[model samples]
Target: MASDSDRLRALKAFDNTKAGVKGLVDTGITTIPSIFHHPLPLHRLHADQEHHFTIPVIDLAAAMGATTTTTAPSERAELVATVKAAVETVGFFQVVNHGVPKAVMSEMLAALQGFHEETVEAKAPYYSRDSRRRVRYQSNFNLFRSPAATWHDTLFMETAPEPTPPEEIPPACRTIVPEYTRLVQQLGRTLLELLSEALGLHRGHLEEDAACLEGLAGHYYPSCPEPHLTLGTTAHSDPCFLTVVLQNAVGGLQVLVDGLQEDDKKKSDAVWVDVPVVAGALVVNVGDFLQLVSNGKFKSVEHRVVAKSVGPRVSVACFFRPQGAATSTRVLQPIVTNGEARYRSTTMAELVRRYRAKGLYGSSLLQHLSL
Candidate 1:
């Protein structure tokens, strides 16, 4: 085991490289560095149980009124019901025909992949730890704080509340980023509307009233030489209101779900289920704050990406949260619930502060915030 000081030095050295995991791969090292090694409990399921579950998939054409002049009341209601069931039970689902052009999605994914694959010199200029920078690239946002590092590098861009200026975007993906985010913002609004109705509130409640902002992260997980020793992403739940993700076919994403059988009474009977790659589908998952504001009616389940030996895996995730959450003084509580509030009322800033303190992969934030 490395001493504390030795590990810190290793972490700082890795960070200084600014080349990210891909840079390490470029050296053709057959073993991952000690910094990227994670502890066990990778949450492997029994072979028989691995393929037994899959997350729900929803078609949003009717809800978005894409095919007809107007969505029928029944069709809209059905859409909301599906969203409600998915959020409440699994907290994750995939959407097909969500109105973003498939071409645009492909372009964005390719552009991001291109950016990550660029020469280290090309990407180095954007490598930064400063949170204020709208566009930044780094290996792990919580590298020093986490118990172990993951095997991915991310190019994170804050695109909403204030859209990232096109000129500031990296040349590889600049043109497509704006277009992709615009369409995603529209899709996000529609989903929030459905979520609002699912909560038995006005259709415009989440989007128009609560007001959510957007943050995009383009994650590049290099092929891990020692896949079993590390994770592509640690098991963690998004802290925002919701997360929308687009992943390429090279899949490794998984969601941890309750696997308890009626005869089984153990509370720890949970399994890691693979989130299969669905062509032209975007994955959506509820986040911690959404679960809190819904008074525990909606679930915010933990999910993670497994490190794989196959090849580079690419995905883009867009996180939505209350606007000005980092510094806002506004307090948020459950909108309307039949029972007592499951979580204490708190401001986004405070919630975020606590989340950062715990780092990703910490115990459930909702449990700590419970009333």
Candidate 2:
């Protein structure tokens, strides 16, 4: 295994090259930093920099009681209450018995891994960072601007609103995970509706407001031979409304929680373990926009990825964001009139545009929405 300094130097070299920004797409080198010469330091989320975050785990079975879809008003209310608590407190939760089959999830993961392990030439075409394309892969968002680079490769696929045809997906894993994407997209829509209800908005309110919906199936493959020196993904927040992540069994995913001392910078116990899979559950997390829209009732917490010494880690993160030329200017209805005002009105387009201009820096989107 290469030392942290060695990995950082190589990544630094990659950052200097145009091909590095293009990631493995251009050079066809799975080990990105090798194209360059300098290794880059991993973005470590220490205790001092961490925040308080505890994701909720909700049971879909509660919603589907003996009453069925025509359940009485009170029963429905109870369901809504549980969902509301999950959204408001943790801004994330897992849904078990969500109706999507376990076989589908397993197949999806297998297909994703197979795709990542294919010959570099086979995956080169999808390597650009241009957000307009439904699918693309790149090393890191800060490719062009950041001081250093992260150690990971990604395969992004957008399938929503209009499902990306099965033919468009790579042939390597297509046969095995043929219907997996479609099933997850359906689940994404259902979850979005639930989020709408949780926000006290009319059912489908968020969906309609978001206009066209898009998703990115992010396949994060860890760096081999030198895991401890780098990261699969750096500490950052998603730019979309919500994200559904499917983590592989390797388990290096950790959420930074409260435990920091006022004067100390590193908090040993600040990081907490996130329960991976609970039989059948889709890990749902609120994004920056949702936090703003909900007036802080919901949160968009910061999380980071760490590299491991064991076998490679695989995670599929599906981001749900607005699309098309829909006016981004959606006025935020006040959530709290009393006590210091929390947020200001903003548009979906504006937020995304700003995020794009900034190029995924560590800055919080919430800062831009201050009253």
Candidate 3:
């Protein structure tokens, strides 16, 4: 067992540097430091043969495009069914023709990479843990509480309730993040509408019921010499209502299908399915808030990223939820057909507070809220 003093001492040392995992890697350490090693017993997960499974892919151009309001009923219904199926089974899917230009996506990624790959001295000023600061860089949100630190550093920006003042963001990263946020916020609204319909609710239900605040977090994973010792991200569900993640082609994402993990549950499913990189597609997942509101109807499964010999695994994720406590406080409306709320009504702020207070080592935010 790691002694409290030792862990605390190491944690503070790392945090004090504000350099994140990439900084440690720059030191050319051959072995992973104890802080990055998995705290529990390590189980080597089996990857299903590529041909054995496929992640659901949806093209939203026609269905969610400008013509959506006038789109043919059959076309819209088919799209809804497809999204609903993906959410029920895996809680995730890839979306193409989502209206965000490929050029925009590529440029945004390049910008993020440039920011993370810059010298430690250059990036240090933006590193912060203060929630009040909208644009900041940090290693792990729960670095102190988590059993081990993940092998990634991140740039986080809160863009929904209000975007970080342009002057506050790193000048080099300023342009892309705000623009990407606007684009994704629009895309996110369209997705929320689709989800509302998929849940058999009024089209505006989610947008109106859930607050529309959005947050974007860019994760930068550096190549690890001892890749097996640390993860890019640990297994956990998103705490928000919806999440859209954009990743570069250096694929390493894997979603957990509950029944597959022998330790997690029964053996109906047997392995993790690779989420392949499809050019110009965004990965979308139903989140904990959605699952809680839907009374367990929608899925919000755990997912993780593995460190690789590859140089960097860059992914930017947008999380959509209420803008503040006031909006988030509204009790979730029961499904009209079901007429019973599974979990007590709570605000997004409450859920988010619980999430921020706890680390990824315990039960999921959704599970913690279950009746």
TM-score of each: 0.94, 0.77, 0.92
Name the better of 1 and 3 by lDDT.
Answer: 1
- Each prediction's Cα RMSD? 2.2, 5.9, 2.9
* Top lDDT prediction, candidate number: 1
Per-residue error for 207 in candidate 3, Å, reads: 1.3
- Candidate 3, position 143, lDDT: 95
Clash count, one per candidate = 0, 12, 2
Candidate 1 regions off by >4 Å?
Answer: 42-51, 66-69, 209-211, 262-268, 325-327
Which candidate number maximizes TM-score? Answer: 1
Local lDDT at 365 for model 2: 73
lDDT of 2: 0.62
Candidate 2 off by > 4 Å: 1-54, 64-75, 173-178, 210-212, 223-226, 259-275, 327-341
What residue runs in model 3 are displaced by over 4 Å at the alpha carbon?
A: 40-52, 68-70, 211-213, 260-270, 325-328, 333-336
Local distance difference test values of all predictions, in order = 0.85, 0.62, 0.81
Per-residue C-alpha lDDT of model 3 across residues 127-190, encoded as one tens digit per residue? 9888877788999989988878888999988875667788887766788887888888888888
Compared with the true structure, what per-residue lDDT tens digits does model 1 show for residues 1-371?
99999999999999999999999999999988888877666535222263345699999988764543577788888999999999988899999999888899899999999999999999999999898899999999999999889999999998767888888799998999889888888888889989999999988888753345567899999888888888888888988888999999999988888875555554445678888899999999999888988998899999899899987899999888865544477676887658687778888788777888788867888787877
Better of 1 and 3 by TM-score: 1
lDDT tens digits by residue: candidate 2, 252-340: 66554445555656554545435455555678787887777677777776666666545456777877776554535554443553476
The deviation in Å at residue 258 for candidate 3 is 3.3
